[model samples]
Structure formats: C-alpha cells, structure tokens
Target: MPNKRPITSEDLFKISNVGEAQISPCNGKFVFVKTTIDEDQEYRSHLHFQRFDETSSVQWTFGKVRDHSPCFSPDGKKLAFVSNRSGKSQIWVISTEGGEPQQVTQSKNGASNPVWAPCGTQLLFKTSLKLDQDESVFDQEEKKKEKKKSEPLVVNRLKYKSDGAGFHNETYQQLALINIETNEITELTSGRFSYEPSSWSPDGKSIALSANLTDDADYQIVSDLYLLNVETKELTLLTDHNGVYTNPTWSPDGKTIACFGNEREYLGATINQIYTIDIHTKKKKCITETWDVHITDAAISDMRSGHPNPGPIWSNDGKTLYFTGSENGNTSLYAIDENHEITPIFAEEGHVYGYTFDEDRKFAIIGLSDASNPGDLYKIVLGEKKKTRLTYINEAFLSEVHLSIPEPITAKASDGWEVHGWVMKPHGFEEGKKYPMILEIHGGPHAMYANSFFHELQLLAAQGYVVLYTNPRGSHGYGQKFVNACRGDYGGKDYEDLMAAVDFVLENFDYIDQDRLGVTGGSYGGFMTNWIVGHTNRFKAAVTQRSISNWTSFYGVSDIGYFFTKWEIGACFQEDPEKLWYHSPLRYVKNIETPLLILHGENDYRCPIEQAEQLYIALKHQKKDTMFVRFPESNHELSRSGPPHLRIERLNHIVNWFNEKL
Candidate 1:
C-alpha cells in the first residue's frame, strides 16, 4: 500500500459494477451483468458468462446497449435475456453453444422480466398495455401519422407522476406468454392492475404473482399474492387484503407458497417477514416471525446498481429456503427450515446484495462488497465459512489507488440506547495530526448505512476529511422497534442519536478538529442537515441535497408526500398543521448560523426542488450565509445514478464548500 495515490472524483469511471448473477441449472456456467460507463458518459451493460472450470469470464453479448436479466432453460441449453439492442427492451434467445440470438418478442411497448416455463418451450414476460387494448395490437408495426398540436396533460388520479418516469399514462404492466419456437404470443391477464410474476409451479399449471386488485388502488397501498391458472386463467387470492405481499415462490410439490411481506401494523415502518401458506387449506404461517431484521437488501451505496432482493429461494427438496436479510451493518444470506429454524449461511462484514443458488443448492454465487472493494462475485459452499473469489472487476483500479477502510464504531445515546456506525479516517493519515471531519447522513430514514463501498464517502476521505456516518433510529437493519422509533418523532430522538454520534467520535478520536466540523446528507438526511444547522451551530458548514424544508407544502408537491407525511410525521397538513409545521426545518430558519449549501435536482419529484428553493430564499432574506445549486434534468437519484458529469460536479461542489467554509 506504499506510494499509492488517493482516490479522486474522476475515479468513478474506473469502477465496474457487477450484479444480477444467475447460476445455470447444470451448475456448469454462470451469467451476470457487468455495467460500465462508455466514453459518451452513458451506461453500457452486457451479459458475461464464465464456466466453473474456467479462469476468466467472457462477454457473451457485444453491444453498447443494456442487456440484463439473463435466465437459463431447465436443461441449461438456451439463455433468455432482456436487451435493448432492438431499439427498445425485448426478450432475446440464444443457445448455450454460442451463436446469433433470436428476438423473441417485437412488442410496441417492449417486453421485460422474462422467465422460462417448466417445459422450456414458452416464456413469461411483462409488457405495458391499455386496459381495453388487445395484446395483438403490440405486434403490429408502427404506422406513420400526421403530427398534431400538443395537448395538455389531463390528470385524474392522485398518483399521476413518478420521479424517474415523469407522468403516468393509461398503460398498465400486464403479463403475457410467448412460444419461442413459433414466436406466438398470448396475453395472460389484463385490467387496470399491474401484476409482478414471481415463480411458476413445478407442474407448470399455475403461476405465483402479486398485485393490488382493490378498486381504489390510488389510495390503498396494498398487494396480495395470487395463483394464476395458466390454462383456465382463474385467479385465487392467497393472502388477506390488509397487508403488502410480494416475491411469491411456489414450493416444489406445489402444495405451499412462500413469500415476503408484512401487515400494516406500523404502516410504512413495518419490517418485512417471510411467510408460508398452504395452498390447499389457505392457511398462512409467518416463518420468520421471530427474526427481527428486514427481509430485503436495504443497504445504501453509490457503487451498486440493479441489485435484486434475492427473495426466499426454496431448496429442491422443499425442506429449506434461502434468502438475504439485513441486520446491524451487514446484509447476509440465511436459510430457514421447515421447522422454522433459521441459520446464517454467509454472514460476513460486507454487503451481499445479489446471490443465486444452483439447482442442487450445494453452492451459491454471491455478489459482495465492503468499505474498500467495489464488488465481486464469490462462490461459497452451503455449510462452510470458506469462499473463493470469482470476479475481480475493480482489481486494477484498486491497485493504483489508496482507499480508506472504515472502522466500525458505536455510540451510546443519552437514553442508554446504542447507535451503530462506521468512521473513515482521512487518506494518508498520521498520528497526532488534526483533520477536519464531516458527518455524512444516509437517506431512506428507512435505509441503512451498511458495510458497503460508497464512492462519495471515499472521495471525501481522499480529500483528507474524516467522514462519520451512522444509522440512526429510523434506519432499517436494526430491530423493528428501533426502525419505528423515529416514525412520529421525526426530529426528536433521531436528532439526538446523530448529535450523540458526533460527540462520541470527537471523544474517542483525538485527531478530529472540533472547530472544523461539517455535515451533509440527501433526502431525509438533507432534512436532518437543515434541522441540525437550524437547531445547533456546532458545525461550521452544512450541505443539504434534495431536502425537505416545509412539510405543509411538501405534502402537496411530493410524489409520495400525500401519505408519506402522515405516515412518518404522524400528522397531515389538514388535520394537524401545527404539528407538521413544528417539524419543518424552515420554521427554525431564523436560528441557523452555519454556512449552508443547498443542492437540488430540478426534476426531482420525491423531494421536489421547491424544498431547496424555500430554504435558500428564507436564508437569503434573513441575510444569512447560504448558496443554492441545482442540476437540470436530474431526479432524486442524482447522487447515485444521474448523468456522470453532473454527479462529478455535485461532488466537486460539496468538496469545495467544505474546504472553503470548514
């Protein structure tokens, strides 16, 4: 590690992301998606295949387009994947022996999420279609028509617009079946509801899926598991309509279905648990009822993309199930038996975001990352602690750079509750040398800051700044009570936890300069930054990105604000305006003394740019030190997946602000 240079913002282009790995049924070959930024600054992803006996992986498909979601046939003779090589995303089929891939579907709206049937003769895919539109219409060629004048967008539903996908249309995600041999297509189900297909029955007579069939789906946020008869088209509801359910996997014998979901006991704060239902008796039992961790990949990092949940994958014998669980600061793989006994398979101090098991369930391909590594695939045996590294995608980049490895730290709140987090020392650090420190907060208020590789944090550490990030009360990975503790108390105990984290770090680490402290976060973290500056002037600088300032107006403008406000803040503007106003950071703007920097995305519908605008203007009117920076055509995910140049610009702005003010 001697004579190595620190990582810079431009190093983002050198990291290659590997995810969505699938092991072939025969256990001889594995395919995964490797994403990299092209010279045009646009993302290019393709399918990569490697044999278990081979020493290196080979690119299966060559293109500048995106090709992902690769699935193998039951016999492992052919591969079906979704690709945009035909101008739009569609299913393509190719033999395992390597040859030209044939286009399977030519739908007008494009097709995705392809799954091979048990017989390997047909494929199940998803497409967008109007409620009354026939499936055949998608197969027809586009006809030229005269251009018309622009029309206004007529809105009726409360959920009209989304963040990444602008406005809502009349189209709904519908399921369909296509025969690969004849290229014949058949529509499965149709209506206003959207169905997400999970697995097919062993006998191939039915399919397990989840959908919200309620009449008022716009208001009622709930989904139920169902069994769709492949031939008869009869739908059978498996769960009550009071909870949210998804990722339904059918048992091998077809007598039971396993899924991950939770009742609305705590609304959006409820943690997901695994459940098994008897198909014949309609009796459901919570398998992971005693397991308190969230049953999904909730780790937040900027170095990963397209990581699937790796839901409950059942063993071939139907006696065991494998899935990923988030706990503490690690997302690990676990297994549950028929007796409801749980065991950790690969519980390491890293993020296992994506994984796949072979047909025999003896080995698995796991995608893992930690503080210093971007990510790579590992092959692990079922009952062993040993693992063999498969892919070294970031080996060359890591060899030339010195990345800070974060040390795990915890702090005790005033109330005696322990808070967990990690601290990254400045690059090229020496003993007895004081350095400026920056407190980095993660969004999701529901998402956890885990042992994952983060480009932003590394860049900050490389800039000679000690970075402190913690999982406060609202973050997942902890038990249910801890995650729900901040629901109704937005800036209450959560704020205390953050302040305590900073105090703990200063007390333990003597090299950190107390006078040169800085704080920055995005989304919910942004809100907390605004709250921190308004309530306390302990930090010399602060940066809030895509943040919320006024809750009353936020409830009307944000995409999920109509219900997210009431669910998180425990109040609505109409019913309890005073309570909502109390949590608004803008209310205490008069007390803010720290130099504040506001960063926002103009097209962000989650925490709209208006939130930043209000905060910047109020601080300006009061003659406070504040500056506003906006990125055009960027959504709420600008920090993670926005344009490459803009993401670098955002990083530069943060580094510059702290260097100048702190």
Candidate 2:
C-alpha cells in the first residue's frame, strides 16, 4: 500500500480577524464586527461592542444575524448599522446604552454605508434601486425558445459582475434620507449611475459625496466630489477635471471637504492623495502632497459616530487634523497640525483601520494590528509611550497554534528589475530533508501581498510546503513608478518579476526541491499561473482559479473587461486586438506541459466561468493533463468567505490536485 498524505479539518476552521470595524461618538464605547467559522464551516459575522468606565467593562449584543458597520448616532445614545437579521440585509438602529434595536429601514434592496445626520434626526444610506428598462439576457434567450413567453422588464446600471457577488441586477445606487423621528424614507438621488453618501455637512443641510451620474464609464474612469442639498434635493459637482475622487468627508465647520482623489492611468497606476476642497470658493488644496503613496479606501479614520459631527473632527476648535497614512508597507496614524506639519501620532508596527479622538484630542481610540496579531482595539493618549489594549477577541484562539513568520526577501528580476517577496518555511520545519514548495501569487496586478495573517498560506505551510509569494510589479505598497511600470504591459515585465522571485528562492533556500515546485494564484495570479505553465515546463503542477485565459473572449465576457483591457494594455479591444491576443495565456495552451488544475466558482461574476471552460477545453484538446473543479453556489470570495463545507472542500480539492501531481 502507498503512504497517504495526512490531512485534517482543523486547517479549515482556524481563527481569522474581521476586516472592517467602527467606533461610537457620544461616549467611551466602541463596536466591531467579529468573524468566525462555525462547526458547519460557514463564515459568520456579528456585531461586538465594549463600554468602559473606571469601575468596570461590559460586553453587549449577541445574535445569529450577520450584523456589521456599527456607527453610533450623534447623541451616542443610539447605534446604526446594517444587518441581515431579517433574511435580507437592512439598516437598523439601537441605543448604545442598552435597548432593543428597532428596524429602521426595511426595503427589498440591500442598504450599506449608513451615516447619521449631523442633527441626529435622520440617517443617510446608499442602496441599489430597481428600474424598468430592458429584459435580462436570460429573458431574451427564453423569448427566443418560447415565442409566446412574457417576461418582466428590468434596468440596472450596476450591471457589471463582481467576483464575490454574482450578477447584480441592480443598477445605479441612490442616496436615501430616513427621518428617525417620522420613520419616513425619501430617495435623495435617482439616476442611471450610482452615488455613495459619504458624510453629512456640519449644519445637516448638505452632504459630501462621490458619484458618477454622467455615464457607466464615468464610474470606471473617475469619481468626483459633490455637494448634495437635502432640503432642495439638488446636487452641485464640487471638483472639476479628470481626477478620481472618493471618500468625501466634510470639515467640522462645513466650509471645507476632505477627500482622496486618484489620477486614472494604466492598471493600478492611480496615485491617491488627500485633498481638501473649500466649499464656498471651490478652491482645492492638496494636503498630503509629499505623502503621495496611494491611499486605500479613504475614511475619516479619526472620527467615530456620536462623538462629534462624524466627519473629520476639527480639533475642538478646528485647527489640527488626524488621519491614517501608509508608507513603504507600514500603515500608521498621523496628525497634521494647523501649520500643516505631519507628525507620527503613535509608534506602532501594524495597519491602522480606524481611529477616533476625545473632546480634548489628547486621547484616541485606535483599531490596529501587526503581522502577528490578527486585529485588536487600543486606547492611545498623547505623551503616552504605550497603548492600552482594549479588546481580546482572538487572543485565546491564536495562542494554541504554531504561526509562521514571513520574512521579506528582495531579488533581481530576469531583466534586472528588483522584485520584493516574502517566504514562509514549513511550520516546525526539519533541518535536512528537502520539502516541496508552492509559489503563491496575489491577484490585483495592482494589490500588494502584505505579511499578514493569511489562513490559506498558513495552512499550506502547516501541510509541509515552503510557500514563496511576491508582490510583483503593479502591486501597491511599493512606489508609484514600480506599479505603473507594469501598466499597458502585462504578461511581460510582471511575469519576469514573478519568475525572478522563484529563482531567488531556488538559489537561496537549500531545503527547496527545485524539481518539486508547484504554482498557484487567483484572478490575475491565476492568469500568471496559466502563463507560467505554457512558458515553462519547470513546475511539476499548477492551479489557476478565477483566471483569465483568452483576452479576446475575456474582453467581452468579464465585467471590467472592456475598461480593464484598456487600463492594462493602454488600448481598447477594437484598437488593439492583436496586443490582447499576444498576452493571452490561451494563445500558448498547446505548449503547456505541466499538469494543470483549474478551479472556479460556478457563479463568479468577475472572471466568468466561461474563461475556465475555455482553458479546460483547450488543455484537454491538446492532450495535456488537467482537471476542472467547480463550486456550484460560490463566487469570487469563495476561498475566504464561502460556505463552510464548500470552503473546506475547495481546500481539499487544491491539496488533492497538488498531491496527485507533485
């Protein structure tokens, strides 16, 4: 009998920290969404809160509902957030001091990003609306089959498919104002495009928002800031030009608005800088010009609900400003004084997701984490060298496991371009014997793979595979030039950068069996895997998930295909079909010699399943070794937040594929 590889389900349910958390304004209280995998293996999220005084601390709120985005009212007496408690996600409100939450807005459409009005009398939210327009593609196909069939008409602006979220039949999102006192909901903006309600003005008469009502492509090109009048139901565009603007936050006095803007260029070449626009004169000033590193998802990091007007808090008198900044892979909190001098607020080593200040601005509530800690809340006061630990959600769970330390390694690319990467040797690695290796790639030729707690990476290490992954060109965390260098030039320099990372590992690590190398990546990473298999026969096995195989067909099928092809290649498909084909992995499938494993969710809207089908068919036709694994009811987020049983099944499938081939 052959020796079987050992496997267990413990790898499937390890503890993980939730991504987003928010704080309360009126008092010394805070709430965060905590995530965990249940016995059934389903990813569940709930709202967890902590209230403190000199005497004692107490925990509040528990339910099976997936509640998230808990923001308190201006009075700090009530909390508003989104929850799927009623089978569908909706906005709800509850008292922060303890009381049953009342269902605030009940609509068939899902609502998110709930912000309380400055007066505390209303709530502003963004939700997708249904409009009467055209028949669905399915309806059209059905009509062809049954001539007499009657179908319903639908019009949606947000028609683009998302990898994690399936076909959204909801178009343009509109802002809605719900009066807390009257329980009346009024649609604020209605159009073909979408607008995100960012924050309310200080006087509560206007709102600062980012939207694209011009066209469908406008949403993709650039977003601009706008001032929306609540009483008059009028909107005035604030910023002029081709800049991409988002996360518009009103200054405490309502005279100025702060937002993050990006200049649209090639793939991930956008440079996001913090800017403050004067509302009265329409004058804009770039606040963090020198700190030009791209900002991810702008937020008033220092403001919490009910504490003040929930926008950027004016230093009790509106002088100094506090915000989050990221530089060279370090995310820290900083304060910009009235003199525009930037100073580090806290000497910390992890990502800061949120923060809020007290009345005196001397103390702050910060949500932070390091490469080791998943995430925890902390209380930081000025002049204090150490932060006070607040929450301990995953402390007990993480203490039991053996964690891998990912060490950063830099290597020169095939073309002499420098590439940055990190490697994790197998947990409890042995000294002499060579171990199999897995080269993991991150998606978002634009996103950077940080040294953070990744469940899958940890599991691979635990399974005795030395995992080597790199932030190739076009990934953030590096400077703009490095990321932009890959734009309009995919599959060229980026591929070489990845190959260099692998070569660096082989040259540096003595315990790596070069012949037993395996490769895998999702999305763009998946595309690279397909590219690698066709270009080299070195890898023993490969897995491509949610990948793009044929750029020709992909331009028509993928949601962002039309815009993304141009963004990456610098030309639309009509203008440069040859360029798209030249970069496609499907073009070289006949030369692929590695045993390839293809995995994709059945309902992935981002990288449609047809791409997977085309690649699998081509490999099979070429007489190459391959297998296709599809999850029925999953989407792009399957690996991270899919159904419990299915997530485990997906991991088992990956392990099975590599085990058999390697």
Tens digits of lDDT, candidate 1, 548-660: 99999999999999999999999998999999999999999999999999999999999999999999999999999999999998999999889888998999999999989
- Model 1 stretches with alpha carbons more than 4 Å out: 131-137, 141-148
TM-score of 1: 0.98
Quote the positional error of residue 460 for candidate 1 in Å. 0.3
Deviation of model 2 at 37, angstroms: 2.7
Task: Single out the weakest 10-residue window by summed lDDT for candidate 2.
Answer: 299-308
lDDT of 2 by residue, 320-363 (tens): 77766555545667776666777778746566666767656777
Compared with the true structure, all predictions reach lDDT values of 0.91, 0.73
Q: Which ten residues in a row have the lowest lDDT in candidate 1?
A: 132-141
